[model samples]
Target: DAMVIQNPRYQVTQFGKPVTLSCSQTLNHNVMYWYQQKSSQAPKLLFHYYDKDFNNEADTPDNFQSRRPNTSFCFLDIRSPGLGDAAMYLCATSRDNGNTEAFFGQGTRLTVV
Candidate 1:
């Protein structure tokens, strides 16, 4: 399967705590992305790594950070979690940027305590 795998499928952090979510792709892809999805809302693109370049979405919050140390792996770090930041974090991969087929992991559900 052309799959993206996310670790520790669910996470709960104390308010203002820092948390990091990880993703690894089985398929060798050029584009890896991180998105945040809240209940009843669309999945919002936070950032992406196209090869060695990093692209951050305009409206993505400063609290969100990402790192692509290598093509096969990426990391999403939430600097400080808040009640409003609790949501499902999705990791995805594609051959290229937008307008292409992307495969997503099951997602990590983050809860703020």
Candidate 2:
């Protein structure tokens, strides 16, 4: 399908270890977003890339960082992930922010061990 694809449907990392989740698409969308969702909580938008411009949510912790090397790809880097950071990380893309429906991947579930 010509939509978003996330690598490694699940991940397990040791406590305090760093982890990187990846997202890619064939849609050539210009905006890519990264979100975190925990049990019983709504998905939280961590940051997004509109082309080469980066926008991070104010509430997003410094532990979260993102990179978009091109229009079809983005990466989420969790530096020194803690047990509390275990959650589902999602990747989504749209032609433009709020201009069209966003396409999402199946999500990468992270577990801290």
Q: Which model scores highest in lDDT? A: 1
Worst 10-residue lDDT window for candidate 1 reads 1-10
> CA lDDT, every prediction?
0.93, 0.91
Displacement of residue 14 (Cα, Å) in model 1 is 0.8
Across 48-112, the per-residue lDDT of candidate 1 in tens digits comes to: 99998999999999999999998999999999999999999999999987788999999999999
Which runs of model 1 end up more than 4 angstroms from their true locations?
A: none
Model 2: worst 10 consecutive residues (lDDT sum): 1-10
Per-prediction tally of clashes: 0, 0
The deviation in Å at residue 52 for candidate 2 is 0.6
Error of 2 at 78 (Å): 0.5
- TM-score to native of every candidate shown: 0.95, 0.96
* Candidate 2 deviant stretches above 4 angstroms: none
